[model samples]
Target: MHGQPPNILFILIDDLGAVDLASFGSTFYATPNLDRLAERGLVFTDAYASCPVCSPTRGSLLTGRYPARIGLTDWIDFGGRIQPARGKLVDVPYIRELPRTEVTSASLLRGRGYSTWHVGKWHLGFEETYPEQHGFNVNIGGGYLGAPGPGGYFSPFDIPNLPPGSPGQYLPEVLTDEAINLIRNRGDNPFFLNMCFYLVHTPIEAPADRVAKWEARVRELGLDRRTALVEGEFFPMEHKRHLRVTRRILQSDPVYAAMVESMDENVGRLLDTLEEEGIADDTLVVFTSDNGGLSTSESSPTCNNPYAEGKGWMYEGGTRVPMIAAWPGRIPAGSRTAEPVCSIDLFPTWLAQAGIPVPDRLLIDGEDLSPVLFEGAALERDALFWHYPHYGNQGGTPGSSIRSGDWKLIEFYEDHRLELYNLAEDIGEVHNLAEEEPEHTRALHQRLKEWRGSVAARIPTPNPNWQE
Candidate 1:
């Protein structure tokens, strides 16, 4: 290990699924770079995001706390894409911006002399609560806007803090260029690069060449004839009741595949830059997503199969995400663990790695996964919880969920419906054992309720406008 604190490279993909990469069982999406990364790092099989949506998970990752605890439970849509939509239950009021008082990992690391830089997708707040205010030394392409602005992932990109590149320039590549520049120019001090890539998200437009390439590949593989998406139940939210849930069954969407490939290529670029800068061994590299892939709505891009519904539902496919950590000589190469860890764990894990003492006053819900990451030891935790009290943009109702050991339980707020699944047995979550195992259900439900109480999680109340 280096005598100095290792540089931290956190690569957060916007809407990547648990199985989006070739390394993580995606036979369709090409991700050679991430596959190579998986070979050099520990692949967390049961890793999870704190929420099904974007901003909540992002906040949880930064603060080492659950979204409910932080009171930032939904995606912050400053672009007016998502407004107040009526559902069975009215969405609870949430903190639109990440509170100034909260101690983010960026702030903590900056205090300890690490040069922190955040690039892309800072939807946690508006201008006042941006990456600069939250402790990043440099903020590029980050703003209140969740997805790419008016330019839509291409140059003439209207992203804040980042200058537009040449016309037709891809946003991911541009963001990566900024990240690589930061690393190359970094001085003697160890740096923290919160490299959040806004790829594989909405407005899924990729270079025509890349899209054409995937399109050709799909035909070559005989996947072009297969069904890609299927219509499911009507949207739970009243505003979108006219539309049914479109579930992507196959990962054959050429455009989305192109976007995924583009993201992978940029990841390769960042990894290559680390090697070129002679800092490969002196850095801790983490690759994960803010939330699961967008499969159940918004064009139904990628399929997260063998794991049930994706991105807004409280299913395995929604919250489960791919997490790979590589720190040469520190974390074992080619290691794999099924230990359940959440986005919240990243904060404490990074702090532990940097030898920073977490203050006692901070009520961090995340546990340090150093032992599991470094020594292949079991993660000592009772349960991981998620509280998403708003109707999902992708057909999910208001709910709170808890995962303890191999068992998972979800409580839907609209009708107070309870769902229990033994993930080990039913990875697809097709079978709900809520009634089959009454004792287990009661125990988990009670624990979930207790956790909500502890976190003071807000619950959605009945909507008065419902005609049903």
Candidate 2:
């Protein structure tokens, strides 16, 4: 409560794999904006989303509470086609409306005399539980649905996903426009702007011109158009049922890269707005992701890199993500740290940075990382845990993972499979050291059991004919 509260610009990317960006190492795609931003900020190599899926991770980011603790153990599923009896229905789970009781990042920031605006995708539930109700004074195009909008570039609204937004304009452009206007209007008492981009996620909608450019390139390479991607963008998987074709789509096509590039362009726009507003020095801009990449099938998949699973699973690839912080003079530019951080940690950290104390009643399960972020504080935790009792879109299936130092223990309840890995050596989780390291496995298992016992996780009804 000393100096003026620093304005915050929190940019969240969707389903972006670390390997896809040029700065992270991919020469296949060009992310000039992101590369430049990293050069002028702190890049975290070990930051993580608390959960492996979208809503859960988003909830953790905003509330600093585990999904399980807040009645959101699974991806926020609803809408779509629901099949009776079978239970294998398609729904928009990311739009799971949160209960009113939960305190959010927006409400806290707004209460601290900050002008708040939320743009881009708001997949956290419905309007009743919209960003406006959560804390933000201004919420743009947010809804209680799956996609904030469409994935196509030209007529992004055609998908009729997040149609409440301005018609006939690029979604990214719209989000940036709103953010810039808010900055220009807020004559300077310090503000909190969450520019959550819906880009690089999916819907495979690239501008017609961009799509044509990619097609011509792929054709030049004589690659089969079936799985061919132009070279810098992600094309939507044409079919929903073809799950096996997902990996083929990502590797064979350049659509994923293209989508990433589109997202990067918007990043530059937002940054330029900040500079124009002359608040760059006092703002703490944070860039991170909702979860991991698509890896399952053509219908619903995400890439998790060296890790085995994508979004829905508690694998390193799914939970671990990039966390870049830019605070002109405070944070060291071009520095990278591997200290483990979780999604829930964002709750207290943001409040602390804004000099606002989180109400004790919130009962957050996260630790404040402001000391680590500002004063080079130490991070010492016995282990970080995950408990996902429901299955989700990222078809990596359902499981819980606990990481302590280099050791990770994963429990797959539905299959009754328990596995352990030494992540320091095996990043892909290829080796199951549970048998060889029985003692450590036993200890971690007991810890998981004890932790699970305390949380009132929903017990999934057993299927009598599950084996059949």
TM-scores for every predicted model: 0.98, 0.87
lDDT score at residue 262, model 1, on the 0-100 scale: 92
Highest-lDDT candidate: 1
Q: Where's the lowest-lDDT run of ten residues in candidate 2?
A: 83-92
Residues 1-468, candidate 2: write the lDDT tens digits. 337778888898877665556666554566798888889887777777877767777877888887777767655556544211111221212225677788987888888788888877777776678887788888765665456443354444533224444546777777677778888898756788888777766675656666566566656666544552212222211122233323423433446556676788888888888888788888888888888666654333234456665665567767777778888887778877767788888778788889888897778888887666766666877688887665544444455778888899998755557899998899889989999999999999888877776665554544343322
lDDT of each: 0.90, 0.69
Candidate 1 C-alpha lDDT tens digits along 9-115 = 99999999999999899999989999999999899999999999999999988999999999999998665556555687888888888998999999999998999
TM-score (C-alpha, index-matched) for candidate 2: 0.87
TM-score for candidate 1, please give it: 0.98
Question: Which candidate gets the maximum TM-score versus the true structure?
Answer: 1
Candidate 1's C-alpha runs over 4 A off are 79-81
Each candidate: RMSD: 1.1, 4.7
